[model samples]
Structure formats: C-alpha cells, structure tokens
Target: MAHKNQFQLLASRRFLPFFLTQFLGAFNDNVFKSALMVMIAFRLAADQANALNNLAAGLFILPFFLFSATAGQLADKYDKAFLIRRIKLAEIGISLVGVVALISGSNTLCLAVLFLLGVQSAFFGPIKYAILPQHLRKTELVGGNALVEMATFVAILGGTIVGTILSGASDSGGGSEWIGGLIIAIAIVGYLVCRVIPDAAPPVPDLKIDLNPVRQTAHVLREVAKTPAIFYAIVGISWFWLLGAAYLTQIPSFGKNVLGGDEPLVALLLCSFTIGVAIGSLLCERLSGGRIELGLVPLGAAGLTYGGIALSVIGGNLAPLEEVSLAAFWGSPGAQMFLFHLALIGVFGGLYIVPLYAMIQERTAKALRARVIAVTNIMNSLFMVVSAVLGIVFLSLLDFSIPQFFMVIALMNAAVAIFVFSKVPEFAMRLLVWLLSHTMYRVRHEGLEQIPAEGPAIIACNHVSYVDALLLAGAVRRPIRFIMYKPIYEIPVLHFIFRTGRAIPICSRQKDPEGYARAFEEIEQGLKDGDLLCIFPEGQLTKDGEMQPFKAGIEKILQKTPVPVIPMALRGLWGSFFSHKDGHAFTTWPKRFWSSVSVVAGKPLDADTAKSDHLHQVVLGLRGERL
Candidate 1:
C-alpha cells in the first residue's frame, strides 16, 4: 500500500482533534500561569511577587514527579481518548478554582490551583506522547511530532499574549472578572475538543493500577534501564527540558533586567522564541524526509550553546531602560540581536527534540512505550527543578546577571551533550553521516530495501572516497560498523567519529599483529551480535575511479560468521570533494559543490554464491560504468 502523507493526518480523524486538544491544554496552562505572572509583576509587592513566581513554577512542575509513574500505568491500562476527555473536564473544574483565586485576589489560592492543574497535566502527559505511536505510521512520527511541537509552542505564544492581555484588562477596574471568564471559557472549549479525539486500544487493558507512585516509578525505571539506548535517549530528552526550562523560565526577568524591557517586551521575546521553534519544528520533516534522524541532536546542541553564549556576550554592559515603544526598541543596536539569539536557541531546540521523541516512539516496544515516556517526564521535571535551583544560585547567590547565566546554561548543554554522546556513539556516527550526506554530497540511495531490515549482514562496497563509509551510513537507515585502515581510523578530526562508531580498525599482520587479530575478533563478534558491518572489499579507497580486487579478509570474516553478503556500490564519488580522485582528499577543491552521489545495495548473496569474484562482478554491474 502506498503510504499517506503525514501532514494529511492533521485533516483526518486521527490527528487534528488530538492536536487541538493538546494545544489547548498547553495554551490553558500558560494562560493561567501567565495571567498570574502578569498580576504579580504589575500589581503585587516586588520581592513577594518574585518569590511567588518561583513558587508558582515549582508548583506546576511538582506533580510530574509525584504522578507521572501512575499516569503511565493508567495510560497503558485504559482508553486514552476517554482519559483525555476526563482530564479536559478536570481542567474546567480547575479553571473554576482559578475563578476563586482570581476573584478573591488570593495568591495562595492561585498557587493551589496551579498545583492542581499541574497534577492534571501530569496525567495528560503520558497519554499525549504515547498515543502517537498507536495511531501514526513509523515514517510519519517525525512529521507528526514536528507539527505537534510547533502547535504547542505557538499555543504557548497565544496563551502568553491572550492571558496577559485579559489579565491586564482585568487589573484595570474590571475586578478580575474578565480574566476569570476567559480562562473558564477556554477550559470548556478544550474539554469539548478532547471529546472528539479518536480512541486507541489500551495496550494492557488488564494492567493493574499501581497506586504507589514511588514503587511504580522504581519499577518502570527498571524497565527503562533495561535498554541502554532508550535510557540515554530519556536522559537527552530530560536535559533538553532542563535547558528549555532554564531559558524560558527566565524570559520575563531576562527581558526586564538584561534588555531593559517591560511585560510587553517580555511577550515579544517569548513570541520570537515560539515562532522560531515553530519554524524549526516544521523544518524537521523536510530535513529528515520522514525518518527519525538522530544526527540533528548534536547539531541542535551546537546551535543552542552558540546562541546562549552569544546572547551572554552581547547582552553584557546594557543598562536597564524604561518601558519604551517596541518600534524604538527594535531600532536599538542590540534588541533584535538578543531576540535572534533567543530565537536561534528555540530553532535548535525544535531540531533537537522532534528527532529524540520520534526515536523513542520508533525504537521502543509498544507495551513499555508509555511507561518509558513517563520515566522521561519524571526526569524532565526533576531537571527543570534543578534548573530553577541553578538559576537561583547563579542569580541570587553568585550575583550573576540573567544574561551572564545564559553563558552558564550554554556550558551545561555542551557538557551534557558530550556525556550522552560518549554513552551512545550512534549519535556521533549519525552526525558524521548526516553532515556528509547533507553538505558536501547529495546521496541518492537505490535498492536499500534489498538489505534485511534487521539482522547480521556484511556489506561489501567499493570505497571511492575517504567518506564512503559516511555516505553509506547516511544512505542506509541502519547503523553500520565499518572496517577501515588504522591510519585512516586514527585521522585527527575523523578519529573521534570513527572510534564512536565502533569502526573496526585493521592493519597488516606484519605491521601490527595484535591489532590485526583484534580487528577480526571484533568483526566476528559484531556479526554474531547481529550488527551491520560495511567493509571496502577492495581493502582500501580506490586511488582512481575503478574497483580494486576484493580483499581476502572478507572471505576469512565470512568463514567465521557467515551472514548474508550484501553488495553495495558507490557511484559518482570520483573526483568529488573527500575523494582521492584528482589528488589527496581535502587537499583538492571539490569538482563542484553538492555533487551528486549514489549508493546502491544489490540483492543479498546466498552463502554458497557469495564468492569474492562473483560479488565483485555484481557490485561492478551496479556501479554500471560510472568509472
């Protein structure tokens, strides 16, 4: 069957209603929170209001730590659509509580309402994320997540604007009735929309509700730790939330203290971030072309770090200013630059998050997916809390300005990224592969499905360039451990990627007997472990545009672990950048920028027919006179 377009899901019964429901939920959360913040900033005591703001943020996040584990159990045990409806209806009741808080002007009651809604959001969190894999196709996950995140931040932008506006009006002798009415109205509409969401069959209808959040969290966390990759992904996702919470939670203070702007300018700062995130989110689908490409994580880290530090450096030395016209502010030498840096952070954030979410959905088993997501939520909440504490330490204790704290956050992102990448080298491998595919060369893959989707396989291809491994890695959806010469594997910049990718480094027995023996041992173990390992059967990169004789090492490796031999061919890499076609690679200019390249995988050769001579002819045929 032909696959349907992912965006089309938005128009169908599967996605649109769910999207609206979540968007509204996020919108409502922000609306009430922002309204309270506006009141505290504009009308309340300065010190007391600042303390309340911090407390408000903590109250909203506390429920996730307390309830996400239970929420995960419930999602797996019941109908998600029904659960959403109930949650939305609860939202209405809670907004009414907000009515009490708003009408009486009780900061205490408002905070209590915030905590209750946070509890509601905690329950809603697991189902919202876990439902996508239940409805959407695997290929559509990235696009779906992109759209969902885009709508979410945009809703945040909406809530910030609308809620602030209403609260502002309420403050002007309207007696808070205006804000109260609007919030309740929004809640009812959310419940109505959630009612239309399609139902997904519960994965474990008979799943016993584990009422103990602590025990349940521990058990689910054990399930999460069973898979190292998924656990690392959870950590990465949590760290992202930490960074986001740190930056976003400070927008109000950052604008006022650093940019010298008022509430209106704070709104503009958030709006820029939301718009930038939306743009970046939408760009994910086009960039990934429907797959969960983990490569973007590292790239996003780079942007996030760069943007944060740049903001810190640029925002220093600026004096506070009175509330001024935005037109005048935008004309200031530094305002737009600050916004640009903030926006850049959001853009990279979108790039970072969508892929990680899709990866979790794509890789995890259906049974444990929701529970795993819950663990991620719990960790995210914890990290956000840590971010808050860090903000206090840096600002109140260490006497750092908000802009200077941005630099500290940037360093935090870098440290976390390096730590996670060290734990899972696949991220590093994909980054190199993605960069090669996107920047210096455009790879057109052919006959990729001819290779087994998952299994032990040895791919033999002509190595036409120094980057042939990268091109092949980028071409195939699966990760491949390549066998390369030790010298090449140890190249200064490329070494880190090669080592992270677990590329088997070989040398002639005469050159290094121990290394050569270790290479074969590793290759045999990898194939036994059901890994895809790609090797240049010619044993080295072709000096000219022609296939070299297949190396005898392949025969030896296959003798030890005889897997299906997949023959691949690289065409149009000769004379291009990274190719030794004209002279030394990287020493010569690319024949042209963005040169076209193709990697073709032919049918897997049966063991009896997988002789070196026969497979050589097959690859040569696939190359088809490209030389």
Candidate 2:
C-alpha cells in the first residue's frame, strides 16, 4: 500500500465531518478557557487572580475524573453518531448557561458552566477516538491520527487567538456577552456537522453503564493493562500531557514575569507552539510511512527536554519584568531563541503523541478501545493535575523562579523518558532502527505492502550485514520473529533486544544436537502461533557481500508449516557500518556516512509453489542481479 499524504483524508466524508466537529469543539473549548483566564489575570487582584486561574483549570479537568469512565461505557453502549449529536447539544446548553453567566458577570456561574462544558467534553473524548477505526481503513490509521492531532492543535491556536483578541475588544466581546453568543453559534455548527457523520456501530452494544467513577475507571484501566504496549502507550501519552500542561500553564506567567511581556505575548508564544505542533503532526505521517513509529516518541521526549532547557537558560537575564511592545520584543536578541525553543518543544510534543495514539488504536481489541481511551483520558487528567500541583509547589513553596521551574521539569523529563522506554522495549527497538536507518543510511523500501498485514508467512531474505534483521523489522509494519544463529543472537549488546523480540536463536546440529532440535520446535510453534517469521536462508551473514548457498533449514520449516513465503532482499548494505567490510564489521571506520540502502519485498508465494530453490531465485531476481 502506497502511503498518501494526510491532507488527502480531508476529502473523505468518513473524516471531514468528524474533523469539523472535533475542530469546532476544540475551538470552543479554548475560546471560553482563554477568555476566562484573561479575566482572572487582568480583572482581579493579583493573589486572588492566580487562585482563580488555577481554580478554573481544575474545574475544567474535574469532570474528566468524574465522568469519563461512565462516558466510555455509554460510548460503547450506543451509536457514536447519536452520542456525538447529544454531546454537541449539551455544548449548546452549556453555552447558553455561559452566556447568562457572562451577562451577569458572575465568576461563580461562569466556573459552573466551565465544569459543565468539561463534562460534555469528557463524554465526547471516547467517542471521538473510538469512532476512527470504524471509519478509516487500517492503513489509514496513522494518517488519520496525524490529521486529527493537526486539527486539534491548530484549532487550539485559532481559538486562543480569537478569544484573547475578543477579550480585549473593549465592548461586549471583552465583557463576555458577545463571546458567549459566539460560543453558542460554534456549538450549534458543530452539532450540525456531527449530523452528517455516518453512524458508527458501538463496539460493545450491551455494555452496562456503571456509575461509580472510581471503580469503573479502575476496571477500565485494568483491562487495558492486559496489553502492556497499549498500557505503556497510554502512560507515554499521559507524560506528554504532563509536559504540555506544564508548558502551557506556565507560559503566560513565564512570559510576563521572566520574558518581560504581558498576556498578548503569551498568546503569541502559544501561537508559535501551536503552529509547530501542526507542522510536526502533519510530518509524522510522512516520517513514519503511515505506520505507528513509536521510535519518534523517544526522539520527541529528548527534543522536548533539550528545548525546555534551552528556553530556560538562553534568556540570560532578559530585560526587566514590565510591559514591552511587540516591536521591542522582536528586536530583542533573545526573542528569536525563545520562540524557537517554544516551537521546538511543541514540534517534539507532536512527534511523541501522534504515534502513541495510533499505536493504542491499532493494538487494542476493537470492542474495548473506547474504554481504553476513557482510561487514558482519566490518566491524562490526573497527570495534568499533578503538573499544576508541581508548578504550585515549585513556585509557591520552593520559591523557585519560572525559569528554574522549567529547568527542574526538563531534568525530570529525561528521567521519565528513560524509565518509560525501558518498560516498553519496542520503543527502544524502533529508536535504534530509526537512528541507524536515518543516520548511517537511508532505506528505501519497495513492495513493503506485499508482506501480508496479518497471518503466518515466511520472510526469506538474503542477509548481507549484522543489521539486516533490524532493517527488515523497521521496514515492515508487523512484528517479525527472526531466526538467527545462536552466536549472532548472543552478541553482548543486542542479546537483550533479541530476547525481548523473541528471536529464535539456533545452534548448529554439530555443536549441539539437542539445541538444534529445540530450534526447529520453536520455529514450528512460532508459525502455529501465526507469527510473521523472518529467516536468512543462508543461515549466516554474507562473507563477501554475496549470497551464500541456501541452507536446508528453511525447506524443513516450510515443509512443516506450509505457509506463504515472502521473498525479500537487502541491497546497499554491503559496505555499510554493520557489513563485513575489510574483514570484520566495526573493525574500521565506515566508508560512507548516510549511505543508501533498500529492502525489496516480493509478492507472497503460494504454499504449494514455495520450493526453496525457486524462492532463492525469486529473491535474487528481486535483488536486481545485485546478488
């Protein structure tokens, strides 16, 4: 399957209506949130204003803790189209209440409506996420998620910009009355658009609603924990929220207190972050080849910390804390660096989140996905709350400055990333592949989709380098069980990864007859388990960058399994870093940096026609006589 740009998804009905509904919902969310924040910052006393701002943040998040579990059950129990329409209708009601509160100029009433809107959003979260797999084909999952992320962050930027501008209008907009009506209009439009979204059958139509949030939330999370990858993806995703909430929550204050600017500057910096996320989110599809490339998650975490630290120190005794015009701010030497840091942080955030989200969607059993998302939403809310608490503790109790707080978060981010990636080895595996494929060589994969997305198959390849297995693993979307010689599998550095990946390590029959017998049993069991099995038919790496005689082991395995065999070849790896160039690999310097390589996959062969000799020739032909 050839990958298409994310923008192509915009033309489809399966995506557009849901996209508009989600975008409008996010837009309305930020419009109200930004307006309230501005009021708390400007119209109230300093201490009370800070208190109210934090209160507003808590009010919006509390509903996620209270309602998300039940909402997940409801989404699973009902048609998503009907549920979304109802949620939008709830938004309209909430907006009506907001308008009344705005007219009355009552902060109490406004906060109440904020909570109600949060409740509406809590119900919408699971539906928005779980409905996608129902709408898009499997290959489109990553692109769909990337587009959704792009829309979300962009809407956030647009709404924040408009909300901040209107709050300063010195008219009814600034006073909140007109802005409330605007939110009402947006809510209605979202509802209308949601009407066009096709009905999505509920995953668990008989799901019983359990009203106890704490118990149900625990149950949902426990179910998700059954799949460690999905669970860790949720954790990684929540950690990202922690980073986001930290930056976004502190940005306005940081801008005013440290950067010597006011609320408008805060808006400007946030716009920069949002734009970066949009660009990064769209780029994720291209970078990952429309697959769940969790490798980028660690890269993103590292960039986030790096950018955070840069932003923290680079200001270097910036001008005094007072209002500065945009002209003066732009002219300042640190301005561009500061903006770059913020945008870089956001870009990495996009990279970290898009793949993790797609992975959760792709890996979870479809019937329970909504509940899993609900569990994720609950964790996200919890993480954001912790971020708020951390900020308060850092600033109020520790008496730390804003930049100092950032320094602490950045340091903590490194620790968190190490821990999370250690827990999920796949993330680290992909990271290795990404680093190798991107740094040492550029890998151009051909006919990758010929490898079936599911079922048992033999991935027979002519191995040329130590990294050949990794090359195939990275290029294919599915996880492949590699059969490697015991000596190579026991290489000190990669032994753990091979163990984690469940690579079948085989010893020669002459060396250990029993071990060799176990190897065949393992291979048969792997195929019986419907694994995608990869084998180097030569039984070892190429000594002269040429194909060795085909081993009989592959024929024995094929005779036992009788599965379709996919012929693949690794070209351009002959003189690469891991290749046996000039004697042993890594004994000398790499002859080339950023070398080019390719993995050519051929059409799957019928079980009846997949004789070992024929398969070897097929792989040679696909290798373009480079063999």
Q: What's every prediction's RMSD, in angstroms? A: 2.7, 3.1
TM-score of 2: 0.90
Residues 1-627 of candidate 1 have per-residue lDDT tens digits of: 313555677886788889988998898898899888878777678898888887898899899989998999888888899899889989999999899998898988999999998999899989988999887877788888999989988987898788888888875677378778887888898888887888888888888888888898888778777766678988998898888888777887777766667778888888888888888887888787777888898888889889989988877745456546677678777777888988998999999989988888877777877888888899999998888889889998999888889899998889999999888877877888788778777778899989897889999898887777777776787778889988789888778877877899997899999989999999999998999998887877788788988878888887878899999999998888777866788897666767678889899997667788988999999999885
Q: Write one digit per residue (lDDT tens) for candidate 2, span 173-292.
A: 445766887999999999999999999988889777899999998887788877677888898889888888888878877777777787678778888888788778877888887767
Candidate 1, pairs of clashing residues: none
List the candidate 1 regions with Cα displacement exceeding 4 Å: 1-9, 37-48, 104-109, 173-175, 222-227, 257-260, 584-587
For model 2, state the Cα shift of residue 553 in Å.
3.4
Worst 10 residues of 2 by lDDT: 314-323
Runs with alpha carbons beyond 4 Å of true place in candidate 2: 1-3, 40-48, 168-174, 321-323, 439-442, 446-458, 512-530, 554-567, 587-596, 601-618, 621-624
What would the TM-scores of all predictions be? 0.92, 0.90
True-structure RMSD for candidate 2: 3.1
